[model samples]
Target chain A: MVDSVTTINSDGSRYFLYPADARGRFSLARRLSAYGLIVVYLLLPWIPVGGHPAVFIDIAERRFHFLGYTLAAQDTWLLFFGVSGLGFALFFLTALFGRLWCGWACPQTVFLDHVFRRIERWLEGDAVARRALQLAPMGPSKFARRAVKHLLYFFASLLITHLFLAYFVSLPELWLFMRAAPGEHWAAFLFVFIAAGLLYFNFAWFREQLCIVICPYGRLQSALTDDHTLVIGYDARRGEPRGRAGTPAAGACIACNRCVQVCPTGIDIRHGLQLECIGCAACIDACDEVMTKIHRPLGLVRYDSLAGLTGGVTRWVRPRTILYGGLLLLGIIVATFAFSSVQPANFLIYRMSGAAYFVGAEEVRDQFMVRIVNKRPTPATFTVSLEGLPAGMRQTGFLAPVTLAAQEELVSPLILLIDRKYYHGAFKFTVKVADAARTFSLARSVEFMGPDANLLTEDDHEKHRHR
Target chain B: MNSQPQPPHGPEAEPALRPHSYDGIREYDQRLPNWWLNTLYGAIVFWIAYWFVYMIAGLVPSDGAQVDAAMARIEATKMASSIDVTNDDKFWEMSTNPVFVEAGKQTYNSLCFPCHLASLRGKSENPTAIGPDLTDTAWIHGGTPKEMYVTIKNGVIAKGMPAWDPVIGQKKASEVLAYILSYHKKGGTITLQAP
Candidate 1:
């Protein structure tokens, strides 16, 4: 390698260091990436976040608790809007840049990069050794390595499958099922088996095909991205008219092909950006190594927009990006405010039967249904009362205060009877809920219907008084 | 129109075509197959037969079944209402009912004897019977008929009282409420004592 440092000018910045070289084999990186996919994909579900599974989609109770927020079926529309907003934002981000998520933030990419690579490196050795092992005939060395690697991979895949189950059915419940006898929880066992099988098949064999074909996000990325978005690109201007290092003046174009050797997807960046490229910066690392050896400037391959490379008119402000970003911020604010404004507990009131309005041997009376919910971890009692009604109106069934156990709901049927003379049309009443510590109130209005005023005569009143 | 030569494996191997029609609109012949038609016909025939037997012929279930279904609906509604912790329809009813209030006073004097004392006045030893001060409007649970029903049914297991749901039943939970609610306006008296 040359002693002098190389400098490449792109995006109005100077790079003093050269890119990395293809010291690691492409096959090794691929195998390693595969192994990483196994570990992360397996462990993701099992990883607990605040005593809860990282991911869960509980659709049965019409309650979905993702992370910590318990979303009721009523909140399904809110979730839908949030998801759509996220999708739009992602689309906008991708349109400006090609396959950025595919290489970086995507779970699939992150898993494959961090988990599989480490495992593969541990088992089959580095890129070159793995490639050599692949090429080797059926011998003891190959057999040992292959057996150990396959066993490790399968175990990792199994762990990943378990974690996936934990995400859907809470870890505690799943753990109980696992601890039970095999025949006892046949349904649970079946679920675990099938889910694990799917996960194992995915990471073990599906691999890159998942990113290229199965993932719709990658396909949609092409539609969202414009030529202006920053992407990993090869400076065909400098690196072309390709020839060896000691050849005639052919620019800085050293056709070493290290860039190709290091690429995980096996695509030539020099051919310009393609859908298959994950933009992993491996090519940058590789080409930098080549530049160092030849004592030339680096960054034959780098991240840049078309405008940036061409040195033409470039505007940083893109309408779609700005709009999507603004919307995302707005959604976040709304979600935050909604969660902050209301305590998790909720209350509902309904009128009961067997009475309408009055208290006598023969009188009209009304019955109501009142419900209290305690959302806290500890059991609590709520003092409930009514407002916006006349002073004579009273709730007669419950103790002065109603206590609810932790996460418990109390339903009370009450009787409300106003004197026939006093009872009338629609009335609005507010139900106030209070613990010893704090109070929350909700209001509801209901119409009171009864027989006409003529239904009760002076004689009827006299009979009721005698009774 | 002239016949176009087919490109040998280019990006566009198939040429896009426009249909000819009398109007501006043209349509594609996409129709359900015979098997699908047969399945649909079978479904319709089955539905008609089922409807004739169940509705027209009066050959379905009895009135008892209808009653059972109604009961089931009531039970389901109760369960749904139970899941909600903030509803107090029963309490509201009791609060408004003088008779229930009278019944509640009776229950309070009987059940609340040892701890709450005879006058509905709280005792230092029992100290409100391991419960809230019924006389005070500041209730720990609530002051509604429904709330009273629930508290009586499911006693504070965390506190001293056992959950009465298994023992007393929901109807009696209301009776217990009546007894306790009687003490709401009356406390600090040595009115009744247990034998």
Candidate 2:
């Protein structure tokens, strides 16, 4: 019955699928796209941008470089926009074209269908032969084929995981680590092996089960998509009645079961849109190839909205789409602004670990610690200056432009002293630091703390009288 | 497309629906996949092994003991790197060393210059400066190198000189002391002054 899962036997044992290969336009297009994605993945760490890998996430240095721009650990708050932007974009796309990412761009599908499945097909022949081989006893020929196939799977997984590690350590450092003994970099070594093992297990035996049971996106289709959303469906209106080729009053469907045979998830598409479908368009291609041979029009099973499949017009502009699109657009705008506003340096002003303000015989003073951090990969000189100080106030420390090495930080005391004559109680002032090239500047406002102005003048009068 | 249903596989009949219904919804009583069940069994086996090794058998050291050992190693390294603050001749030697003086100068300019002035002259260089002159042999607290170390390490609170030992630690405090001593001779004329 269609009520139960096709890949689960009645005895509760696993039921592996041997999906027949489908060849048509959609299959060809998806193959090309998957290959393009795989090439992009493999080349990102090899390509250098601005003296670093294109997408290096240098966790050891706590600097994440995307394209040419770099972000220090302090700029980690920008990750909020990145994560949310991806979420909203997915929501919008899912509401518009259902499960497009799953069938096309998802790493699981790309690796499993394009990479591992091709290896399996080349070694074991077509679907029927593969099923027969599985049913047969463990002979020498069968054992050798299984061993070679699994060995190849393990190697492919290891290669992928090694490239994945290059994203974090960069290609040059990864090469160094690869050449070194595993004991020297035990953590990274363990990580790569463990990740590769997991990938091998996932791609080798746990194939369609991951999409049907593990992935939450497939389950969210009902909530993310509606009637008008594009989905691969059977045209029940045009292909309902079952009949042979020459039967009168028969619909276009000739009961060839080509759609069911080519299903990767093993669900009958003619039974209508179901959760098991990943929307890969395999059934559409299979049905088209079948209908063309029998002198019937194509699209017996095709990509169409549920409304269109039921002989109704599909509405593209729905309330769900507008909301999702608006949210995605807002996230993009905010993410752009946040990324552009990231400064190449950071500074902070804090009270030195002492009395907030010092009072001496001839002056009133405020002491602060100004900490400056250069986030660039090269050395830069920063000039520290004070602004909005009262007249007759003298400044000390960081008088000259201090040069800091790459990613270096410095903490120095900034002392501001006002002569007793010009000391007019406590006031607010700014401590500003800027690069030598005047590329950017950071300022912090600090309140000069002291006793009342009247008290100082009264003390002065008392001193004069004593003299 | 046929009205007739296909026969169920294996020895089992059709999957039986649960007797109870909640708002017209009854779930089927289907057995879980063997592979999924194997994962549960594997987790149980791992838990037993881990508990036996780490908790009951105690083959591995406790986390607390590991932390204590790490802390002791750090303490040993700290003690090895620390210098004797009470040695007067060592202070004089560090004062004469150019590397020590240069490092001390950097620390001095960053911190001590605010009160003592960049020249270490304090009130002598500018009448408005906050601290006493370090260049003079007259000492308000003490005149010897050890006494100067003590004064710098534990400042005179009544005079507004902060205790710097906690802020800069023993090493940088000693370095700043060396920078101050760089301006003076080892046996220069010394006089005691009342605060």
Q: Which candidate is the best by DockQ?
A: 2
Docking class of 1: incorrect
Per-residue lDDT value at A241 in model 2: 88
TM-score of chain A of each: 0.80, 0.96
Q: What's every prediction's RMSD, in angstroms?
A: 14.4, 3.3
lDDT of 1 by residue, A1-467 (tens): 01111111112122211111244243246436655665655565566654445556655445556566565554565765568667766766675665666766666666555555456667776556665666789899789877876676677666666676676676777788789997898976887777666655555454554664457876665666666777888887787788887678686767666676555554567777675577777877677766877888877777787676666544556886777677777777876776555565667777533234433433344545667777654677677666676544544445477667766767765444455456544355566667766655545555544456555666467777999
Tens-digit per-residue lDDT, A398-461, candidate 2:
8789999988988887777888899888888888899999998998888988879999999999
Candidate 1 deviant stretches above 4 angstroms: A1-78, A95-98, A125-132, A168-172, A353-363, A425-428, A457-467, B1-195
Q: What is the fnat value (0 to 1) for candidate 1?
A: 0.00
DockQ, per-model, please? 0.03, 0.39
Q: Candidates' interface RMSDs, in order? A: 23.1, 5.6
- The DockQ value obtained for model 1 is 0.03
